[model samples]
Target: MGTALEDSEIYQKFARITDSLLSPEIEDFKDSGGKVVGFFCSTVPEELFTAAGMLPFRMRGTGSTSTELADTCFTPINCTFPRHCFNQALEYEFEFLDALIVINSCDHIRRIYDNWIDQLDEPEMIHVMSLPRKTGDRQVDWYREEIAELKGKLEEHFGIEITDDAISDAIKLHNDVRRLQRELYELRKVDRPPITGAEVLRVMVAGTALPKADYREMLQELIGTVRGLEGNGDHKARVLVTGSQLDDPEFIELIEGQGALVVTDATCFGTRLMWRRIDEDEPDPIRAMAQYYVHDRPSCPRMHGDQPRRLDFLKELVEEFKVDGVIGERMNFCDIWQVEHFMTGGDLKEEGISFTQVDREYILAGKGQLQTRVQAFVETMKGTD
Candidate 1:
């Protein structure tokens, strides 16, 4: 799998999508007069956007390695992840975005949305929705209403109706993407998976950034190539990384370079995005998307009262992937995950899993310190082995 993917043109395209905000594929899509809707968090019901005859692009600060432009509008005290994305927008990097839909998943992101409206003139349309912090029957209903409202806004703004058939098709398309991603992860169930964690992260990012149909085809091709490959399994340990927004492949490479294989990650761009598929059987596809996004999706720290659910998912990944330890990292100034680290770390301890937590800026620095810690964790896992 590794050999085939390294040689595949599709894999190179996926890698390029990860390194750039708008890939040539997307640029061409926009140039053809396609509507592109940019979104920030997973909480947004993207299937709705897709069904609305618009392309949903996950906004990231991938190319903006520096926050110099963002710092002018937002102080250093804000979370760097959103700031970095804002910096990219300020530089007209995301000029192709026709509209933006933001969710209040965290304070930092919400503030960035506010600044985006106030300071930016591109993205002719923008909408902010409040994500319910709880997962319950009533919360699901509330989210369903929120999704309906978003659909209405898009319909009015674009003068297009998102009919049931369009939504049903979108649901199936997204589910197919999730199914292929899960199959890719299942390859890592082997002691030494054919692909590396950095590769997995890149594929996941590509799924979000590229056109769904195009990504789905590329993924199917990659999966078949991976299934026939064999891994040496010579790494010191198999690790699972959980964190606040880990879109950068370089950070995963840095950790893997420490003689550990990152088999699975529980971050937003990782398992959280791929774990669940929308309920196609539901009479109304809109309600199905709402249910899946609010209840069935992987729980983030922001989902209050879902710590147990989150832990169970992590434990499942640890057991399934043969993880030696878990890395809990939070973006610097991300208070939500910062508080979650203690709770999650304690639970992992009781379950007899080794856990380590670290804080990082949006773009990583202090590589020497990070490598030392990961190397120590690798040694610990190796000693136990």
Candidate 2:
């Protein structure tokens, strides 16, 4: 398992950005290419970037703040990811970046684009996009428009034109990935998912970091070897997880280890990005993309706080995924999720969803603590079965 931690120590250190740290990777990329764009989302449309031949990298926000670096550029009220990254960028930590793209996937992202555009002077092209949250024709049309608008932006900003063939080729690569991931998810539906939650997280993160073609192949190989029998678990428990900014996989591994699979989840890094992408032939990508945000299984703390909507989404997940219980994974210091954790936890209790809460951290070395929590939850969920 080439976990995220498998990388060099320097890379891991770089991943944790407080508002104070200067970002060398961000800066160096700028220096190398002179100008490149950043995509801040769980998913960026690979087709557009690949066709354009421009350097595109995913912005993985740690959601931690460095008060010294970020204080002047972002309001304290903003999300940590926005405050920290924007703070560093304003100080020229990302001077090499000529532009950035933000999709309307969450409140923090919307705020990030608005504040960033307002701060940067001429020559900075900030493209704010609307992402369609659901699947089908309405979605296809919206994503099509999004692709076109993005194409136009590339033309205007990079002085490079994106052709229809490029769009088609990009879509094909992404679609192949989509198909394989869907198959892999189906394999996970079994009693024993071959790849661990940590592994799954790695694959998903690579979805952002690696090229689409490589990621799909890696997943296909990893998912093929079913982990065989689960060493833990009471043999039964439906599990549901709710959280925000969940790019890490330690917690997911814990719950899965305990004898239950994470059939359903509500997190910023999961389905919110997983289910969304732009295809080649969608006529109106922007409209399709915009509606995806409103119509999909809305994520907590980000969407409207209507208690019923929260419960409905949870209940539906439980039923569809056949979950036995629910787990809310909060990071040790994630303020946004800390609040949502309570709201979602309370409503879940009211609706009679068996559940537990764990405050997890991002440090990759502590696998033992994670395994313990997961074992206990699985045992609890099994409940004398």
Candidate 3:
């Protein structure tokens, strides 16, 4: 039954986009004189770019085969995610972007801004935001100022104005995207989900690649299509995945291939991107966006003093989705997520939730080992049941 949904035309369209760095929609958008601003972290607001009449692209290393070229610039011990992304840039995979935006989410990601400025010739405009490590009123205010600064840069560089009304409209448009995504996630709460985790990831990653309006329409059609199909109940265990910046559906597919249904996740590219909405009625849309993005959404490890809140959020998802186990997968050398995964494994175990931790490369390299670990974990869950 899940296969029926995965085989649909719309689902295939999403998969095609997720499978590559450049998509046809992006090419068409470029052809139509639309500018694209590529960003690294989820903390960077996409609405600001939309308000500026430019597409906000979430950068990823989807088709990267190796970090060979990037290794010359980055150390061997750096997190592979950013290394692969920089490799993609070096290979000219991201030449379509008119500008690039980065945030100080972590040391590994923050380095991209320095290296990009020194190395890249394309993406004429490169900017980075200094995000606060703690959440507070002052921090939110600071972030709002940062957003305003970026907005001003866009307006000045592109010879356009990101008016308050345009920002408000962009907020409303993105809120619709969030609402539709929440609707799709609601379907995953069932005993048997019509859509697989890999398929859902494909859809989510597609959102980062396509224009918000086009992605919203495709999501609407997809949610309607999925609702009509029967659910797939063939998996042995219900699992929730959490950890480092995951953008590849193949990693999720590897876990699901081991007879576990990845019902939900707390990863950057997954629920974290769509879980919260910006207040549409706030007279100051930038402040509203700052409040929502900085304080309201789920906190990743980069945000200090939020570990308890993150664990609580994961536990809530476990209860709601009836998750049998949690898999904490992090990229090697990601100090923040490494600490988070350690604490999460111990904390979730204290609550009697089964937890397994995996260390993976930026690209999917150790397939046999990952498959073995996942298979053993699923078997253990089955036995406990």
Candidate 4:
């Protein structure tokens, strides 16, 4: 018989949400007169949208199978993630979104904003945010001002006044989400976790798709159920996955299928977004958000001069989760992560860690090759033991 956690209604809901681009919750939210604002990157403070009575959606190219339409605008050298995203937009896959806020995370991603405005018709309220390349006092201040500008734009577009009190309330609400996710991650620290890495990825992706309050409630239920169940002791090695925008659960499933359990990850869609909490007590909510998003949280490769900090955080996860090997997966032609993986591979080797890099498309493909590599890596680790 399966465990209660495996058969839970909430777990099923998470899978259903992740399997599609527009989930039932999103359709219901829209039907009830709620506006949804899709944002490209994690750097965008979601609290602002929540405070302004809008749903903040973390945009992904989940269901995209081809970049046919987007190919006319973009070259083959660009990352496929953004190509698939733009393809989805061109196909009217994201027509439900009332607005889109793009961030200059990279040249390819920033191009989406331009292409979107030129092509799309329904989502008239499109905005672009300039993200700082490095972290510093000046950058923090600059981000804070940028956030304020976003707030002003929301107010102007929606005719809604987002008060400081409302932003504070939103911060508290999102912080609750961060706390619950962290608690869920803590469960993975055990030798035999009740939950699998694929399931955790589904839950994390669902959080980005659904309403915050609803997602939080489901997470609390999931954590409670999974905590009581006996852990699964059916894996050969524990692996830590880290790299570029991985929102697909099947990729983790592929790795796990090769006799390795993906215990944890440092990907943007996973730990990077949930690892840190914003200050609830800070008087200036915008400044607090800017500080947390820009400075405090785990920095992605786009942030210059932060590779050392990123490596330190990855090493800490390896120790905490008892990771056997680290797999660094990056999308093809991702210049930033290509450099990051090269640096990380050498650095991790110097620390006496097992590391391998995998280059893949935005959509999951080449499973046989990936499986062969993963199986060899797992067997190599077993041999070392």
| Highest TM-score model number | 3
| Model 3: per-residue Cα lDDT at residue 181 | 93
> Per-candidate RMSD vs. true structure?
1.6, 6.6, 1.2, 1.5
For model 4, residues 302-356, the per-residue Cα lDDT tens digits are 9999999999999999999999989999999888988999999899989998999
Sorted on lDDT, best first, the list reads: 3, 4, 1, 2
lDDT (10s digit) by residue, model 1, range 254-331: 888887788998999988997988888999887898789889989898999999999999999999888989999888
Clashes of each: 1, 28, 0, 0
**Candidate 2 lDDT for residue 265:** 72
Ten-residue stretch with the least lDDT total in model 1 = 1-10
Residue 232 shift from truth in candidate 3, angstroms = 0.6
Cα lDDT for residue 335, candidate 1: 78
lDDT of 2 at 23: 46
Lowest lDDT 10-residue stretch of candidate 3: 1-10
Question: Which ranges in model 4 have alpha carbons more than 4 Å from their true place?
Answer: 1-4
Q: Give Cα distance to truth, residue 86, candidate 4, Å.
A: 1.1
Ranking by TM-score: 3, 4, 1, 2
Candidate 3, 199-298: lDDT as tens digits: 8999999999888999999999999999998999899999999986798888999999988999999998888998888988789999998988888888
User: lDDT by residue for model 2 over 1-385, one digit each (tens)?
Assistant: 2333334332233233211222444355445564456777653464567567554556654333354565575565555555656665665656545567888766666777777777777337878877665444566576667766887888887798877666566666765776665565555555544434444455555555444554566556544443332322334564667776666565565565665666657665555455444434555433333344344435445443444666677777677666777888775555656776687678777877776777764433367876777678777656545
Task: Assess each prediction's global lDDT (C-alpha) against the native.
Answer: 0.86, 0.58, 0.91, 0.90
